[model samples]
Target: MSAAVRYDEVEAGQEIPAVDYNVRRLNLVMYAGASGDFNQIHWNERFAKMVGLPDVIAHGMFTMAQAGRFVTDWAGDPGAVVDFGVRFSSMVVVPDDDQGATVTVSGVVEEKLEDKKVVIGLTARSGDARVLSKARAVVQLT
Candidate 1:
């Protein structure tokens, strides 16, 4: 485990180390089962293509969850997140192959709040597309 990062030690514009989240077919299937989102686009490639998608696409909520994980892991406490939200700007095309699609997430402190909290701006990209936009998280620290 890494050392805990205190709110006093963080600086604005400091880049959080990026993490790549792999989305494989089985992973998507598991996510679908877990979230009860059986959207055909997330599992059936033919159905996805018929809907004008390139291939099976991952769910927007799945992508959002991955981004949330990025922030919580960085904060070292999932409960530290006070508020979190994201806008799904693009789809994450998932191909049925060993090299699954990778969603890269990174964040930076944008502003420090009054009571030992900070606003974190997040960016998530996958397959030459910006998947999440206007993603931000407010975290409380000690």
Candidate 2:
């Protein structure tokens, strides 16, 4: 494990390294099983199309969880996150192919909060669409 990030070391505008997260159909299936959110749009392309979606789209909560993972991993402790939220700006279309879809998540320290905390603004994009907007997390650091 890496060392914990000290609160004093980070500054506003500092960029966190980006990480690519893959979301395959199988992953969606697994998530659906685990989360008990078996929404047809998440795994059924035909049903999704019938519902007016271009294709089988990923769950918004799933995308939010991945974003949460990005922040918690960076903070080295999931419990460090005091606040996190996102708006589903766009759907992440997942094609039934070998390559699947990739969600690239990047973040920047946007503000230094009181009491050894920092507000990090996150950006998540898939294909040409911005999937998550108004995404931010408050993490407590040593």
Candidate 3:
């Protein structure tokens, strides 16, 4: 899909609606299988605590992907994102309950660049801690 955001229509400091993504034990299990990252800290609560984590934590890549989804979803196309990066600031502790955990992502148009590209600044939080930091995406808009 092509980007639905027109470069001429967006301005710096504009806000994008926040999106909350659910992270459950099942989802982590699936990601571990697909990504070949079978680290016990991601799915085994006991193991996670034994390893000094608060609880079973979500994979760093999984959290990053969710944040990236927020940007791609806003641009209306995954391919429109020419660059994306983030630093894992905190762990998303996933409990074994039905409610699991929530990762809330919010974004802003940080700057407009040449060639119809824009820099989008992103923040992702879970519980009281920010899960991702320095999250940004460079998107090519039509």
Candidate 4:
């Protein structure tokens, strides 16, 4: 909840430090249960492979949430977020293993707007795949 940033203090082109998150089959299972998105591609490896996916993949919404978390966490107060959106660019393949998968999130301040709002550009990657594209958020700062 402590983003440690303010609109007045931020400047466009400033980079937010990247963060890495671990994703495992178990995590996907839990996400599936909580989201009621029991898509086989998200849990059943064989089914996912049968469908031509590399393996059981993380839910698109799940990956989107992760990016949302990255943006909101940087904005400090979640309520500061005025808008957010992204287009899914690639799948996050989750292999069943202790190593799991690593999702790295990074961003930069893209622009400043009226009403103490700042636009942030976000990026998310899992392995070599860019999981999200055109990810952006607008946040109102105090």
TM-score of each: 0.96, 0.96, 0.96, 0.96
Write the residue-wise lDDT of candidate 3 on 43-138 in tens digits: 988999998998999999999999988988899887899999999999999999999999999999999999999999999999899999999999
Per-residue C-alpha lDDT of model 4 across residues 1-142, encoded as one tens digit per residue? 7855767798989898999989999999999999999989999989999989989999999998988888878878878888999999998988998988988999999999998998889999998989999999998888
| Model 1 lowest lDDT segment of ten | 1-10
Clashing pairs in 2: none
Model 4's lDDT to the true fold? 0.90
How large is the C-alpha RMSD of every model relative to the true structure?
A: 1.0, 1.0, 1.3, 1.0
Q: lDDT: which candidate is best?
A: 3
Candidate 3 residue 99 Cα shift, in angstroms, is 0.6
Order of candidates by lDDT, top first?
A: 3, 2, 1, 4
Task: Point out the worst 10-residue segment of candidate 4 by lDDT.
Answer: 1-10
How far off is residue 26 in model 2, in Å?
0.8
Question: Looking at model 3, how many pairs of residues clash?
Answer: 0
**Regions of model 3 farther than 4 Å from truth:** 1-3
